[model samples]
Target: MQEKRDPLLNITTASSIEWGPCDPSVITNPALSCSFFEIPLDYHDPSIGYGRLALAKLNATQDRLGTVFLNPGGPGGSGLDTLNMLADILSSLSGGFYDIFSWDPRGVGSLTTPGEIFCFDSPDEYNVFWNGTVELTGIEMTGNFSDPNDVHALLAQAPIMQAKYDELARRCLRHSSGKFLRYVGTAATARDIVALADALDGPGSLVNYVGTSYGSLLGMWLINMFPERVGRVIIDGIVDPTLLATQETATAFHELADADKTYEGFLTGCALAGPQGCPIASAEGQTAADIDATIQALLKQAHDAARRNTSAPVTSEIIRDELLSVIESLGQAALFANTTWPMLVAGVQAEAGPESLTARRSTRSARRRTRRSSVSQQNQTRSYSNEAILCGDSIDLRRTRMSEVFGTVIAASRNTSEMFSVVWPAEFYACPFWPVRAVERYQGPFNKTLANKVMVVSNTFDPVTPLPEAEAVAALLGDNARLVRQDAFGHTSVSEPSQCLNAVMFAYFVNGTLPEDNSTVCEVDTDFEIFPGVNTEAILAAMVPRKIK
Candidate 1:
């Protein structure tokens, strides 16, 4: 029986696609023994094809089946890169029986076409557009964005960029080798993934996958479309499709609040750690440290510099510093598996002292002055990724009545969080003007109730996806998902190299044993520690092989 065609399918040029082995070096390190495959740029549509897919084959024994295909959460992040970063973890869990593999998605990583979409040719361009402007109360606080007229002019440029993107999309289809481009959507990608069991492994072989953040959405789509192919799939920091169409603003605001909570956790932990080199302080319970005060001072210095048109100001240095601090602080708990709290405590204390704050303020002032002069003469187009991914996946920002209802919240956040929140006002206007409406909307009754051996993990404090977001995911996944709460602060719960957390994840994936319902907590240090300690090897031993020795 002929199946009904997907209404969203783009039927462009119907041509044959060519597939061949890729340059293994492109994906695998020269030191590793691995091979790769290159699928034509246009996987489904032959006529609209240069885009190539680079697939990496891991070290597995003969008679092996590929169970795992890892995709990092970004709608734009490279799957191949994610596998490489987590190669050690993958090897430890899947063992010799499962072939672990990854591929560069279309328009990402090695398969990226000759276009300016993903790769910014210049670091300066990225820094300027993404990090250049300082906004407050929906006003550009510094540089060329200071005027309301300037804001309108910049917003007007999105259409021009959209036109350019349209041309690029058309060109990509016109020039490709096969009908592949038509099938690159998440649903199609899932189908292609299922075909791998046949292309690379024996009959009836399935896929065991690990997808995080945005990748979780893809995982869900795959599971819904091909439930039979799923084997020990782990969807970490899950995203509910139900929330994508209706509650984008609520989601964003919730995440920001979570970020604040994470920051507070870090600060409290830092205070306890005491004053050594860390700026925030290492002492555990103390109100006098006033880290909030320090943040305010830093911001005020920056604002003053901007106003005076001085050569140096606090805003420039502090913005970058704050961004790095939060990212580093979060990474420690999520990625490095270290108790960065103590170190952060020390760092904050050291920096917040009377002498350091003055120096930092002066340095920031200098940076602000320089940035002000440079950005004034520049004319650049903003990249579309920020809007494309968010708006595409979101419900509608307009439904929230953000500005009117959240005015008090925004103002309070600005006062409490210092100037950082003020510097980047929400892009409320872009959602209203998004070029394309979401083809499909996500509704509630998210699949939290699936009766599967599911496990969910999250940091106590996460900046981007945040704890609340994770909590929502847990609630949505319901009985099927077990929540593993790491006693840490960050964006992703398991990004930190926590032996205990890793053990739970590995056990669940390799042995099909989910953590118990309710809270299963793993403690991680707040700072990096290099010493002969903690027998993590035992946990590693338990997880390294899929089959018993």
Candidate 2:
């Protein structure tokens, strides 16, 4: 018997598209045009409703090869925003020969569009959920015990975390509309991609795409579900679909372990760079090893103080939060470490006296001001949308008990990664009580070969999606995929400035070229150097490719 084809491939109606200049304040590009295209909220049931998915297009300055669809990840990331922000760099990378296009998926971005997912009615409510007076809110749900050896404290706090999650879940369900939540999964978003392809590229045309981080998950779903429509796909920062699809304790442990390894890499890298290369390195005449030992001692001091509820300025919570910030931007660690490491040191030194503590507080406040603005109101909606999609996409959390989840997290903290164990497992905190599930989720035959070879990129020491996960994804996709191993410390390899990596990617996107070998490893360009004390603006400017006028 023949398999049923996706009806979206047969869609004949042309999408009503309008192009207008983007808001200059938001996107300085005068040439960039933004628009909205209507797609069915539930692709399986057109009767449900139609919603507009926001899109932006930057036509190639020179001759265009074709259109390349881009997704920046986040599960809730705004592809439209990505294109707007990186138009010049992206166009340059594509050799000024491909039109770059991206969209904000349903339930993300503006509520003015149909099918916006809302967990909290207002930003104030969302802030309360994440950073309110509640003791068991936000990061508190996963108690900030800095030492991995603090197993007793972690275990004791597990029940409290579980209870808080339960309450949070109940609150989400009470606040959000059930109808909107049901259609926010990655599978549905994949279908939407197909619909957009059908409309823009003509009916039944294969999709040419690039996705990073969580966006890689979406790409995997698209190719597996609609293999015939796959074309020139690159899944960078690959997420392990097998692990993500299930409720496995081992998977959670492995992810945190990966994060811990990445953190270790940062410390090692900083030490090797020494005093001139790394600001966090040991003082004059001291070895890098000495610096590492000092950091460990300071961390211990802060941990003990927090445990004792002392008046010490540096608490476990502050340490954990700072560490997380560093981890998130590990790709730019050579530059980021200059500021973050100093801040960390300041926090540790604060225990010396009231004067030191006051200075540290002032420095922290100034740093906060210099940092990017808090998540905008639209981003709050995006955050909730991310939760809805993740909950809907993964195995039903309701099947597992909250205690089991908490226990697993505690066990991971104790056995695998004391420093980062809470990060991944904590994401599951509110999942057990998620109010809705996707009406039609994709249970994959993920092993199927695609119509075209897919390119998979992984960082050697990615804090989030690690090397093993990318390798697993490549193995799962069989001969239809090739893994590009980037020897760098970062979440996504493509976004990092690497000439060799970019050359490989460019060849594939422009000329359909694959690496000569099944597995290709690329090294960082030695010429690209990041030094301590370089202006942050200069660092960013150096990273971005020069745009062709």
Candidate 3:
């Protein structure tokens, strides 16, 4: 009998993309198209199975320069969703001369895809996993814990937290098939991009691409893996692959410092805005320093109230979490500042009466619960796949003790702001108990110079990926890459309001022009609204220069 062939292993490439109308609900534009492309789950072992990636494309309005691939970060962010939302603006940014493409990376998108990374048996079960015993039984998973006694109290809960992580790992194994878990690492995903590039632009052609945030990691891996295939690539909001490749507990703390810097930026910005501009600022002609003191006092009061188990409307933990959240939304800080500043003011201004506090707490709790439910529904597999990818990519955390990890992080946080310290390190706690790893992880010689020089963008005050990491990535890529530093505050420079950065990117992607200065520093529009609403026209207009300088 003849040996049977794996049908999915057929690797012939010839423009397999078939574009058609996207769902009107997803994208209102009639100009865009959507399609699904089949790729192997494990590129090295094609016999394992095949997976389909959902992709969205917008044709160039003018003569096509080439295809530009985009990834919006979130080792789990839906590229298709991002492309649908930003297609028009991105097209204009490219000078209307390139077809833009984005997709849902393997292990993400709809569960209908073959070998999707399923962790829970059902959505309801996933919700319980998020909001139940594990969350409620801890010493309130996050807080500044500046007090030594408070730090010790959190430390004491390590055993309980460890048990919860082990249980979660076991549940993931019980609920999800093990075959696909080994195939979702950044390296394996990079292979899928290679295959897609071959299918779309012919085998081994240079790839025209733009990657942001976690997406920048994808770009780095792509160039290192296939240097000759690199085209005019721009990696914005760089994540240091070197740190990611390590197992050090201190690495997490260093990451937290990025957020801490952005938090300080928020306070400074508020002070500069003044009492009339910043809701949190006292109207008594208080300086930024005075306002900072007042906020700290309110936080201390909330912390004391929570320790007493009083019926306060908000707790120190809640305030800490909200502050961290606002920092994360620094891309839209102006709008978030408008909302969160008022809430902080309200919390500080509330009376000490139990009935009054209880009523306000009840209303806030209801709204938060509703918002959490909606977010959980939308992000059904985000947490699962994020853990899966991190665990699958890094040094196994199973060998490390949770107590040691938490202790190191807590100690490190003392040197900086402890506000975001507790929550940031908590993410890696489950890594020690993760169930699987990729079969062929890419341990890199990232220092290799590429066939084509690439462009990198970074913000001086990014809340997530910091400036130093972007510099490190550029250095690692040797002299082949240029780093553009945007003097701004946000996680990613692309989406944030910056005409100079946009002009730089447009010149590179459209005209193949590199900045004259290797390490160029660009300034943001001072008067630009960080929290500009969803008016795409206004955004595009802002990007387009009325007169070329």
Q: Pick the candidate with the highest TM-score.
A: 3
Full-model lDDT for every candidate: 0.46, 0.64, 0.66
Question: What stretches of model 3 exceed 4 Å from their correct place?
Answer: 1-15, 111-118, 121-144, 177-179, 248-251, 310-313, 344-382, 424-426, 529-549
Query: What would the C-alpha RMSD of candidate 2 be, to one decimal place?
Result: 7.0
Candidates ranked by lDDT, best first?
Answer: 3, 2, 1
lDDT of 3 by residue, 1-549 (tens): 112223464343545577787766556666778877776677767768766777788888898877899988766677766787788888988898888988878666563253345566665565465442324322333335547777776677678667766777778777645556777788877877777777778776788888887788888888887787888899988888776677634346555656766676666666555565665667636554676676677777776665665445566555665676566555555655576655655664563534544444433322322211111234443246555666687775447776876777667557645556655324345566787777766668687667778998888767667777888888888678888988666668854577888888889888888875556878777666433331222332323132211
Alpha-carbon runs more than 4 Å astray in model 1: 1-28, 31-51, 61-65, 95-97, 110-192, 195-198, 201-205, 248-251, 280-289, 310-321, 324-386, 396-430, 437-445, 448-452, 525-549
What's the C-alpha lDDT at position 305 in model 3? 62
lDDT of 2 by residue, 1-549 (tens): 112235554332454466787766445677688776766667677777766677788888777666778988877677766787788887877777778888877666662243445556664554455442212211222233444555554556556656666666666667645467777788878877777776667667878888888789888898998999898898888788776676534345655546766565556556555677776675555543565566666666666654554445664445554565565565466655576566556665666444654344323322221221112344333145556777777676546665576677667666766666654323445566676777767767788778899999987767667778888888898789989987666568753467888898878877889986555878766554434443222332323242211
Error of 2 at 501 (Å): 1.4
Q: What C-alpha lDDT, on a 0 to 100 scale, does residue 73 get in candidate 1?
A: 62
After superposition, which runs of candidate 2 have C-alpha atoms over 4 Å from their true positions?
Answer: 1-16, 111-118, 121-149, 176-178, 248-251, 284-289, 310-314, 331-337, 348-375, 378-382, 530-549
How well does candidate 1 match the true structure in TM-score terms?
0.65
